[model samples]
Target: MSIVTGSLFALALAASPATPAPPKPATTTLAPGVTLLRGEFVPGRQPDGNTIVVDAPQGLIVFDTGRHAEHAQAVLDLAKARGKPIAAIVNSHWHLDHVGGNVKLRAAFPEAKVYATGAIDAALGGFLASYRRQLAQAIDMAASDPKKQDGYRAELALIDAGERLQPTERIAASGPRDIAGRRVELQVVAPAVTGGDLTLFDTVTRTLFAGDLVTLPAPLFDTACPARWSAALAALDASDFKRLVPGHGAPMPHEQLSQYRRAFDGLLACAASKRAAAECTAGWIADAGALIPDAEQAFARTLVDYYVGNVLRGDASRLEANCAAPNDLH
Candidate 1:
């Protein structure tokens, strides 16, 4: 399968029965100064990413704004409840699920400066343009069904009007940065999750905000470089962070991270050996152990298909090349 074929498959998947949108985001306190805004990414639904908020001495710092306006509002409410103004917003990657609420959040807190890896600009301009077109077609198909019309219309409006906020501070490289009186180490892992993947470590809380670099149940292999992604996971496993917050799942401990890494490694090895998609998927299923519950079997299979067809079968060099150059996906 090529990139074009993978993209078409993705669009076809999107046009299928709409997955249910997540309810209000739930909050989890990771540490004294760290709070996680957990969101859901149902395989076929309105997938929104997770957000992490840190209450520093100067003000509040947010990691990723989530996919929906309501999700972003939930984060804003949490910040208000903490009685700290949002001083900065750090986007982990260019995916809409991670950075969709950036514009609204920035409008709410004008003082908050947005930060992201510079490569996100190209993703927003290229890959996302194609994504928007596919999403519009999906919405149009859904609109014909009275039962799904309302939901599809709402999503369409969001796609048409939602602003893609540009990063005020483009991180050209990874290094230590001070935000709101707290020291943060930003690591830019390229051609992994996307062109520019920004992972953050909060020295104060000992937590790692791993964007799409690490996900539970199964990884979203869309627009990923398998080799680089595996390496990134290995680096995360070796890190000193006490807890890891993934882009779309619950916060994980080191043990869970290990499980994910093993599964990912198995899948990659199977693919690299010129195995069939079914073989790779089966290998991952075995390596994943009990992570895939009976109810989530369908979701797991979808992700596996995506990984094998999109990430594995596609040309690795082409994927890497497109990361630097603007994708003509549209």
Candidate 2:
């Protein structure tokens, strides 16, 4: 089987027999000629862990390292074990979970060029500045609530310990780049997922690395503009890709992505309609948890929180007020 297909097989085997299943041998073939090393990060499974290392001809290219130097080391080890040299590292966005290992990766592969979109560069700038601001706040709050004081100190420590990921040094032009025998095409689908989210496409294997662009359990729109994100999902449907490697959850069929988009669009529409009628937060929304299947009700609550906290409060609302009607196309 091809490496891509093989990789899928390995993942499937690993996923099967959830309880007491014997560990499958560490097989590197995830597909034909392509190798995917599932890193320690799987979103929803863990808040701060999600990274994947890919082995291609050009060397090792990782998609989104977790939130610390140690995570990067783990990825490097897996790559080294497979006889793959660290070549380049890329982030799907600037979220701390995605880019936390930028400093470490650069240190490990100094020759490897880090790539991100202009928007991500700007976003990183904002992130660093925000970190600084948080530090200041932490310092100011040190004398307040004891719990708050501890939180502030921890936050500051994180900022100080993390390497400053400068954009110009670590960023790249937003487009396709050939890496280790694989044609990696990076496309910015929309502002959903995150302000300048991008997905990597492997033309050779027809695989698309959808960086948090599509997630399970109804996905997360708290950090992005839902309207734009919904639009982004629509665009992804039109784009060509056979296998999708999501930033979170298991690798999914293309249709699952579309299904997720439609669900989010539906939730947003319901939220907006209520808001327009001045009854946005009525009892129905309060009971939203009961409407969806128990499997998805939790994520649905997150959507409701966004509607209330962001849209209603006008705190970080990015999508204006309209929730476009959902369509069968997603």
Put down candidate 1 lDDT per residue, 101-214, tens digits, no spaces. Answer: 887788889888888877655654556556666656756766656545555555445445434466788886779999888999999887687777899999987889998887
TM-score of 2: 0.68
Off by over 4 Å in 1: 1-21, 146-164, 315-330
Give the number of the best model, judged by TM-score: 1
Poorest stretch of ten by lDDT in candidate 2? 1-10
Candidate 1 has what TM-score? Answer: 0.87
Error of model 1, residue 52, in angstroms: 0.9
Candidate 2, after superposition: displacement of residue 190 in Å? 5.0
lDDT of 2: 0.54
Q: Write the per-residue lDDT of candidate 2 for residues 1-330, one digit (tens) a residue.
A: 000111111222233222221122122444665554443332122233245566677787777766544556667777667786777777777666577677777767777756655455444345445655655654574454554444345434545544444333333334677865668787764455555666788777787777777654345544456667777778788887887876755565677666666665655666655354223333323433223355554444544454454443444323332222211110
For model 2, the stretches where C-alpha displacement exceeds 4 angstroms are 1-46, 124-128, 135-175, 275-308, 311-313, 316-330
TM-score of each: 0.87, 0.68
